[model samples]
Target chain A: MSILLHDDTRVIVQGITGKIGSVQTKWMLQYGTKIVGGVTPGKGGQVVEGLPVFNYVEDAVKETGANASVFFVPAAFVLDAFFETIDAGIDFIVIVPEHIPVHDVMKMRDYADEKGITALGPTTPGILVPGKGKMGIMPASLFAPGRVGIISRSGTLSYEFAGILSEKQIGQSTVVGMGADPVVLCNLPKILAMFENDPDTDAVIIVGEVGGEQEEKAAEFIAGHMKKPVAAYIAGRFSPQGKKMGHAGAIVRGSAGTYEGKTGALREAGVTVLESPIHVHAWAEKYRLR
Target chain B: MRLHEYEGMDIFEKFGIPVPERGVAGTVDETLNIAEKTGYPAILKSQVLVGGRGLAGGIRPVQTPEECRTTAEALLETEIKGLPVREIMVCKKAVIERELYLGITIDGYSGRPVVVVSTEGGVHIEETARTSPDKIASFKIDPKFGFYPYQAVALLRRAGLDGKPLNACADILVRLYKVFRQYEAMIAEINPLAVLADGGLMAVDAVLEIDDSAMFRVKKMLSLSPEGRIGNRLERKGKEIGVTYVDLDGDIGLISSGAGLGMASMDIIGHGMEPANFLETGGGITADLLYKCMDLILMKPLRAVFINIYGGINPIHEGAKGIVRYIKDHGVTLPIVAKALGNHQEETWEILKSGGIHVVTEAATEKAVERLAALLNTSSPMSRS
Candidate 1:
């Protein structure tokens, strides 16, 4: 079974009337996701893609028993929308939009932690579960059904990694975007823990990059607790120091967040480290994971 | 965005954190007036965001009006670490009994605010963390309740501090933490938080960097600079165009839909050509944004252009039209290569190829880079790094 999402993971789209929200809602539905309904304050009694919309999150949850949410609210209102989801007891949340102020995210993380709710991203690429359903804006066609569980810090790299594997006929069970922001709610170690408990996943792939010590922590956790084989590919290998390359979080500050450090840590933890994302099939072949 | 030294002091004074007597000036006449008000032996420091100001001839101690004029004029006109100085700060120099370092910043790993204190002040914090790790002490703040009273004391006590000196520094740390939280700053630092001869502590130098993402709400809380944060002109233009662009010392102009792909486009080892800049369109792309993106990338020195994009949430076909429009408008003849896929894939390829842009429809980014290397007529061993 999938870790956070499964056959019964009912999700409600927040800000369903917006351009991005409506477009992604259509895509998610087409991808076989179990999107129950939607929420918007003013346009309560509307329908988007045949899904009923309600005024508030609680109303939507009351009507459809929606336990998960994916938001495409504008940057300014994300704080209120996120708090509403947390208050409505949404078990899972995936925030898709970028440029939400970091302080608002910090407060969201704190409240979500207090309630023990799982929130994926403020700038995440969203999560995809092949052959079951999907949430967020990941191109569902690029993935295949397999036994590999993948987690990544960058959305585009994860797509490349999964696309390469799909080309090689190696499918994935669940591919999670860890959110590209510097301060994400879920760290590598925590998502690894979730992947470990997922019965559908046989092996886990840690797709990381230069910028922060999340990889080091994941390496430590993998060496100590994980039983399934782990493979990793850290991006930004030749990225210059102190310059923000991709994500706000993907920077090498001083001596802490470097490509060498992340790769070294994972290798030290007995993880099969690939030189690049295109070499993902090599890891799958070496482990006979396909 | 990193705040200038005078701006940091303005924030510090508002928080009741003691700072040196000073005022910011934009011209030599204003500089002389402020320096005269501070009497002899004044400090003239350039107001810049970049580091290494101390050794860049941007900071000097002047004792006479003539010295102040010359130093202030030179600093106002000069660039520190390639960042132009627009203002100068004149402060009444202090007699320091000792120097200490104290700062609060969000730690990368913990995703929590951290407080760091060191006895070694007047030195770059990075150098201190690298060369003398033992001399510095840091602790993460509890996300729920924030810094406890004893944590600040613990930080200073590790630096052989005791009694009055310890209490004073700890008090400053608490105020600094408050300012850090209130402003939503990424970095709030007081280098050489000087313990003066009169048994008082003042922030001799200050650094406060607010997270640019928070400016939407934070602009209401604090009075920001009227012009806002000063940045590289092209970087500022990139922000206005709703993309992230980083100018680099390379020969190839590169653009991608995501940060990961942009860096990958540059890191291909066998290509042997360096990327001139890094630009990420970040999922949301409009024809206008794409048209403007071409204009921005062309501002840099480049031998060729390489683009890697995957459209998940982006309307990439519309973006292709913008690229074609830009090519026609500017009459650009540089060899350009693109690997764009997902969503309306065939339409995107048609538009790009019609513009005489070499297009690779493969999922692998290496294929695009290899195509670029061949187009550049380079036969060096080509492979992904």
Candidate 2:
């Protein structure tokens, strides 16, 4: 009942021969992600970590029924990799490469929207639906099957919150890394809506960095659609104002994407904002304990 | 990848847009030669990547060869936004009877590319927009049909341009689109498109930002990268130290993942610390990468080093190993601290413990800063042997 990845989602790794691809593939496999096959241009017939490698995504998808792809391709080739995956009918694509030119991101965003393929990020940590399939580079050990749905812009922060939830015997339905890119089309509110509708989910924890209208958008969504208790923590409180953050979309342009601004918005929308990352678990606990 | 005016003109010429005859000159002699060759009463513009050069006095009108030399010398000596002027652009000065602005760019806010035109041009467009919002006319360029010829024609006509100038403006608009499409430009601009006394149109100032993804097609564009534009002493030291640092106007110094982390780190800095420069070491932290990161942070004379890593499966241990290796290979002398969690945590800790680098690990951001503050308070900061 979780979002993005699930048990039956067979995944393919593009650029599987590259260092990052090879390393993450091993981890994904170790975590029991159904690594059906991989795609490497010239190294088609080679086998990597027991999984077969294909020359193209189409061949890999056809042969393995892999509907998802994790792109470990470099920035220069990311646009082509995205197009190739889309052309090959891959439904979901997680792009981990960061530092792509802004213009390239604009085109990639346009293309992804046009195709309706759930494009996660150019610098995202990927998605994880607990006790099921894992994609991107999220630490699988932090996640346990639970009812708390978590979504964040930072990868490690998600792990920290998830670990906190896990320690308290509270598992997660899903955790999404929305990336640092400005596009917040699939943000916390959207995920919250899905989690709220899911019978297995009881509460939601939104971990947001200061930047963009994403938190505001999520707050609006939560205000309207979300009936379940939502606990939230927005990072970058100590961050300097009017500074650009790590993500392309995370910059605090004027008042937008600021931690204070986001927290204010979330609070106005009836979200119980945590004072610190550690407080997220405490708030969730109080809601459960009550 | 924002292109300098010279690069923008090159694309403009290719698309048949009428820009003032211009050539980039690195020396006063070259400036004089270009001014003479292009004919006198020319404009010598400092070739820098940043804007506000006009206010900074980087743009000058040279009526004589002596004036060209003085202007070029003045420009080369001056620094605009931390970039020293190395080259000055010598361009033929047209009799600008009227100044109009024209630009085609992606409106990131709207999630679509748009064509912006204005009758008021010579001044900063942003300032003008805030002052006289009604003077600017903007039209969204649909990706399906792009900037239509009729839209361009109508836009110019509405902007108080008519007759030959309107036709010329339309032609330039069409050409600008070609340049934008050909080079995969994110922003193609011709500020103050002058209506000469003779009723002809000429672009006086241009700026183009090429899409980095399309670098494969424009391979030669790498040679014209802003790296050689205006390098500072700090940047040079950073380069020497093997870190990638950009001097920023903030108290907190950031060194993080190449683009995403770098950007996120900056936002985090702004959100958490103070206005700071973002130093992205791109990915794959080598001893060299860490050195570059540290050097960039030091170059800005940052008070603290905020090393935040969300290196998923990228292995924090490898990153920590790089940092430890950097310390062992080249001892650092600065107030540094970072937070790393995930992937190679155990192995990363092993490297830190075995290396004995005196690294601090805390879940609290305050503790991380406290450790950095404590290091800064030391009488003699640890010196690299």
Model 1 chain A lowest lDDT segment of ten: A243-252
Docking class of 2: acceptable
Model 1 ranges off by over 4 Å: A243-254, B148-150, B221-229, B269-271, B379-385
Q: What is the TM-score of chain B alone in each candidate?
A: 0.95, 0.83
TM-score (all chains, Cα) for each model: 0.95, 0.82
Per-residue C-alpha lDDT of model 2 across residues B332-357, encoded as one tens digit per residue: 54455676656666666677655554
Q: Scoring each candidate complex against the real one, what DockQ results? A: 0.42, 0.26
Model 1 lDDT per residue over B58-131, tens place: 88999899999988888877877667878888998788998888877777566677777778777555566667
Could you give candidate 1's per-residue lDDT for residues A22-112 as a string of tens digits?
Answer: 9989989998999999998899999999999999999898899999999888888988989888888798999888887776777777787
Full-model lDDT for every candidate: 0.82, 0.70
Share of native C-alpha contacts between chains A and B (below 8 angstroms) recovered by candidate 2: 0.14
Structure candidate 1, residue pairs in collision:
none
Report the Cα lDDT for candidate 1: 0.82
